[model samples]
Target chain A: MKKIIFGIAFIIFFSFLIVSAINMRTFGEPTYSEMDDYFIENAQSETGANNVVTSVVFDYRGFDTLGEATVLFTAVVGVVALFRGVKK
Target chain B: MIGNLPYVAVVIFVGLGIYTLMFKKNLIKIAIGVVLIENGVNLFLITLGYRKGAIAPIYTYAPSGQAMVLPTPQALTLTSIVIGIATTALILSVAMMIYKHYGTLDTDEVRRLKG
Candidate 1:
């Protein structure tokens, strides 16, 4: 009896969640009220890249990408150093 | 109309990859899931640079003033794919080390470094 009640409650909760998720806004639609014309105009010359996303990732935010790569490298190194050699 | 299929594919691949990462218990499976996610992201980047009717960014054979798919995303995707390969290799190597140490690939069983 208790299990049945719990199952029913779970179904109701999941139904609500599914409905809400269906109504949620997705990220694909562009929301910018005013598109940056400068980015579109000088993307090639300033960034020296034909893709805007690449310009955003490599040139505009190159330092951030560098830091991210460094962090991942450090994590790998740390993992390797920690688990160097031990017989199973 | 069909040009948007790649974008949908990216989303589906990313969603499945995340699901695998969250649900899989084996360290190797998790590593594979990460690779899948990286591939999905790269595919999305490529799709974003795609124009409905555009030639490759190369200027040699293309006519002047012709639309060209953006080259920057392709370059970035190349770099990202290389990074993803490196990461997958490193993770697999670590997983092998872990297996050697623990005799198991199940992440839950390898609890030597747990806090």
Candidate 2:
């Protein structure tokens, strides 16, 4: 009985997620294509990188990548610390 | 054509990874699932930059005026792969520690670290 209720709740929750994902739209004018085109055109000369995505990930949004790495590092460190000094 | 097969492979691998993560009770199995997912994502990123008839992104062999597979995704994939390796290694080490401390690999039973 409890398992049936949990399964029904899980199905409903995922159905809601599916609907929201399908319905989600860009908040503003779609600039990614235009920006991507601009980046592609000038990426080789400007960034010395042939891959536009690489330029975007490493150059245009490097700070964001750095922050992401930092967050992951901190999480790993925290997890390690939490489990430290335990008797084997 | 044939090049797109890698994309499908990535999807399948990722799906399998998620399934393993969701259903497996062993912490080591979950870590392996995470590695599988990382490899799938890396494969997807590499496939995104693939061109039908392009050579590797080596500058010395780059054709004069022909289309080439994008190199950025390769670089990004390299970074991600390294990070994935680091994560898997760390997770495996943690799992080892957990096993040493708890004498079992079942995630449900290893609840001491939880709040």
Scored by DockQ, the top model is: 2
Q: Per-residue error at A77 for model 2, in Å? A: 4.3
lDDT (Cα, tens digit) per residue for candidate 1, span B1-115? 2334555566667766765776678999999899998998898777656654666665345566755565556757766776787688788888887787789998678887777
Which regions of candidate 1 are displaced past 4 Å?
A1-88, B1-3, B63-65, B113-115
Between which residue pairs do clashes occur in model 2? none
Cα lDDT computed for each candidate against the true fold: 0.66, 0.67
Deviation in Å, model 2, residue A78 alpha carbon: 4.7
> Which stretches of candidate 2 lie above 4 Å from their native place?
A1-41, A48-57, A68-88, B1-4, B111-115
Task: Kindly list the per-residue Cα lDDT of model 2 for residues B1-115, writing each as its tens digit.
Answer: 2324455566667766766776688998999899998988898777666655655544344576654555566657766776776687678878887888899999789997776
Report how far residue A26 has shifted in candidate 2, in Å. 24
Q: What is candidate 1's lDDT per residue for A1-88, written digit by digit as tens? A: 8557756765565455444434433323323312233444466688676665567567765775786677578767866676677457
Ignoring the other chain, what TM-score does chain B have in each prediction? 0.89, 0.86
Over A35-87, each residue of candidate 2 has an lDDT whose tens digit, in order, gives: 44455567778889765566767887687568657756865885678577866
